[model samples]
Target: MYSQLWCRTGLLGLLWLISAGFMSAQTPARTELTVTAMHPAADSPLRLGANFSLRIHYDSPAAFRLRIQGERQGTTIPGITHASPRYGPGAGEAIAWLAFDHLAQLDRILLVAEDAATGHVLTSLALPLTLTWSADAPPGAPAPVWVQELNQHAQLAITREMQAPADGGDDFWVNLFLQAVFLTVPGYIILQIALPWWTRDRWRKAAWAPLIVTVPMFLFVVFASTAGGSNLAPIWLLLVCPPACFYLVFLALFFWLKQKRA
Candidate 1:
């Protein structure tokens, strides 16, 4: 019986060590993303006229490609003239231009992207192709009325409205997180204190008390000082100083009590 118990204890210890290591490794780590482009607009379904340009934006740095597949009905056409690469972590843009001497016909097109290092396809977005231009009036017919002035003015007005704000969602989220952290820590600290008193587990009660009370309060102060207000930082920091110092006193008290009991 003694030998059997010893063997079981050894196996349990090994299992616990493995479990602890796994839990530690599971902590969050940063990740890097690769972005690339796959297809060009010339091969798109719209079969745009030779006079056109395609612009693409990527969220990360990686090898990009633009594939044009189609035929031109008109005389000799000018092929792709220039290619450029942009770099950034969150966003980047690419511009490709196509020019032709005379009007041309086109068929289908595709776009694709892949990781430069691993050669893995990351993202692909197909764009609709379109081309429209006026043909010469019939021999006897009069020219159609064109409204270039009003259209140009309206386009400029609309472009300004579209570029107003990047995104409002992030501001709301940061505010919400700050509020939750504010409310949660105080309650958690209170519960920690109540349980230890109720159960008479001095060590556990003491061990969790300082963390439960201090960590949340510290995070709340950070969020409030940084995200809460405008530029009145010096005053806010001064106002928050007393409460933080008081919390530290409580932490010391708990530690002293725990040590005495132990």
Candidate 2:
């Protein structure tokens, strides 16, 4: 009876050890990412419209990909351009351009790890950055008109294991139509009326019009957005047309009243 009991106990211990080993072998290893080196280092301010490089090391699987994406309204829009290595995680150079403006001056770039086959975001990290731009520096490439139409107010947003947001909609077409009627047509009419009567000397003075209220207000809005939040999609004039028209009319009236008094 004692010999039989010893054989059974030994067999049970062997089975437990084999099961634990199998479970360990079945679990996938977690990947770790490290930025080994980067040019225009984190301390250095980035110039708007400039491209930069980063050298990164990771132990990611062949199925995983590291991507540079821009955050907008809690969702990410495709970044300007991120050319990362196609193969697995190893030391590699990332030459990417982040679209930016005054609002982006203090913003950080977003880097994410994704499972390519599953379209799920597994992890994310923010790359601290700041930007400065000269007037002549090219304007950042604006996101596609339709970008904003994506899940603007999505609750099921960026987090671990969530499927990536879908990127297709009719907002582009709708906005374009509205822009033509309210923005393009009205702008053309205003240009026709003003340009014909204005002298070359007036053009120089008019250039300062934006610097007075428009530029200041735009910058103020950008500052507020940086502190608050920002819309990732850009529909130029869609949001600006109505209010701008009101401002233009009031501006014209204000200038006329001052000139008459003078």
Pairs clashing within candidate 2? none
What local lDDT does model 1 show for residue 86? 22
- How large an RMSD does model 2 have? 19.5
Task: Indicate the TM-score of model 1.
Answer: 0.26
Question: Positional deviation of 189 in candidate 1, in angstroms?
Answer: 78
Measured on C-alpha atoms, candidate 1 has an lDDT of 0.45
Give candidate 2's whole-model lDDT.
0.51
Query: How far off is residue 62 in model 1, in Å?
Result: 2.9
- State in Å the error of residue 104, model 2: 1.7
Prediction 2 TM-score vs. true: 0.42
